[model samples]
Target: MVHSNRCGYTYIGESGRESCCYRETWDDRERCIWHEEIAADETKPVEQLERARAPPEVRDLNGETGPREILDGTDVRGTVFPDGMDLAGVSLRDTDMAEVGLRNATLTGASLADATLVDADLRGADLRGANCWEAELNDIHLGEATLEGADLRAADCSDAILRAANLEGANLEGAFFDRADLFDATLSRTRSYGAVFSEARANEGTELDERCVYDHNSDADATRQRRESGAVRSDGGQASDTTVAGSDIDPLTKAEATYQELESLCSENALLSRQSQYFVRRQDIHTEEHWREGNWSRWLRARLSRAVVLYGESPFRVLSVTVAIIVGSALLYPLGLLRVSATGQPLMYPSPTEPIALVSTLIDSLYFSVLTFTTMTFGLYSPVGAGKLLTMLETSAGIVLMALLVFVFGRRATR
Candidate 1:
């Protein structure tokens, strides 16, 4: 049996702490909207009712018989616009145009608060100064659209295609852009507080401000591309306006300056990925000799470390080197270059007499090579003659390898 509140909703689950009272707050005798007492006199706001009513047949903005409408300030709430419909400056507050075709629509300054535009085809639309608060724009295609100064608070734009879109000075607080295509889009000064951009592809020209906090698991490659390409300037403005006095700067020179600036900024901030990308770009653009002139030792060491340890990111490379060293030592041992001996006794040289003897000697040599390479001693075998020198070399290599492994693992842990 279920315990029912005055709203007729059930209180299910455990009786005490783990129960759910599916009803409105009980403070001040409040009841759910569906409760009979509340439903009797419930009435929607007049503005909402007016918005719920459908608009007249679409027409041109000039009051002509054309399909497009320049009905600026005209309320077209709840209207289903046809494909290629132009409703520039029209008010569409609380409209229910779900699955409507609005491709190439001119909805500039349109009010779309609490509207349902699910699956709307708004590609190439001009939505400058538009209001889309709490609107349902899921799967909307807004590629190449202009949304400058648009307000999109709490809007759900999941899977929206916004490639090359302009969202300058837009307020996008609490909006969702999951899997959205924002490649080359300009989001300068766009408020993105609590916004979700997981899996969104933004490249160079995708400007950002300090307020933006994306999902940590978002596409790192896209972020790096934006940073390296100078698409992600700190200020929410056009890249041309970044340097006040460089208005006449040539494109190549400006690009180079931006790269250097970003490189310096990223290095200071300890943004290693962006810094590495800039370093690589500098290497590619400059002459080989010129690029390698200054800090030659530092550059050489950095490159060598990356190759040997994969920038301290790969354990497989470490393992491969270890295996190669062991194999090389094993092969040398079997060539009669590593006879075993005791500290004060004669050396135990290999005798390739019978097939069994040769096989046993080879196996023993391989085992001894492995033990020496690992710097481990069982006291049962010791190196003689040239083997002593090899043992010392192998021990030193093993120590270095072990130290590198430790450093790599520690760096990875902190990262």
Candidate 2:
């Protein structure tokens, strides 16, 4: 006797507790629609004149037939919402909602802790601030859903399809996301300490905050300390986005760890192109961190890497910078930087020794500048007094640029 026809749903309120007595029967079962044992009962669609009718309370909330308040606190656990449902702020912890069709449902602030939501269809659902701790969410289709600030800590989300979902500031600590698809998902500010992302699928569009290192040490406990902090989230609820942070570990260390972890994931999934993207970002954070700590050598190397080849990500930039150097050096050469090797005559714009054509002087200076930059000067021209120093600088810069270009080209070819 799993159920009776008295609609015996219990509801506890601030005043007292009460049991429902709605006279209805879901098919041949001895219960109302709200009290139906949907998980246990097997059925086939058929015309039955005595079938149960939907109560006036939960009448078409998503379609705006009724307000969202009527269905709150109702015991609709183990019930399937095939079309769509609006149960915002509903207390439905520990429900057997596995394999249900909840497409486009509004469950904001609902308590779904320990619920079995395996293979459920929650695409485009709004679960903001909903407590879903330790829920079984494997293989659920939550594409384009809004789960911002939701508490999904320790939840089993393995094999879940979360494409384009907004999980910003959500508590994802210790959650298992193995083999989950997170393509184009926004996980910025998510507390993902001890969270397993093994084999999880992501791309360049997947947003992750390198500086979000909210580990267990930084956050005292999941529930109690967070509630005490009273920090409101971006979605108008309490989330893991509080400004309180601990300095026990360097932020760059955690940021590098995150990048390395993701980079390895990309490499294993044959997404090698995304690996360089992560590498450049990792170096950026490393450079910024070292600059603040006064590490001149590390900062200088990182800065040079960016200026030369964009940390070896952009091969085009290498060629562009080289061209810029050559053109700039050519313009600087006309200011008495070159001389004739045969006559030892200085090459200047006005030419105090003789009236030189400005156009011809510029052409000659450009030719000399190109030869000096390539470090292959002929006997027809020579560097004058100050030109010797300028030539040395230009030659050094050219050598470094050429070497970096080769390295960048080789790296890009492998990718």
Name the top lDDT candidate.
2
**Clashing residue pairs, backbone N/CA/C < 3 A, model 2:** 4-30, 5-30
What lDDT tens digits, residue by residue, belong to model 2 across residues 116-178? 788888999999988787778999999999999898866899999999999987877657899
* Model 1 regions more than 4 Å off: 1-82, 85-291, 342-359
User: TM-score: which candidate is best?
Assistant: 2
Which parts of model 2 have CA positions greater than 4 angstroms off?
Answer: 1-79, 164-174, 183-197, 202-254, 258-275, 351-356
The Cα local distance difference test for each model comes to 0.57, 0.69
Provide the lDDT at 118 for model 2: 86
Whole-model lDDT, candidate 2?
0.69
Compute the lDDT of residue 193 as modeled in candidate 1.
41
Tens-digit lDDT track of model 1 for 82-155: 55555665545545566555677877766676677877778788899786767788888788889987878668
The true-versus-predicted C-alpha distance at residue 354 of model 2, in Å, is 12
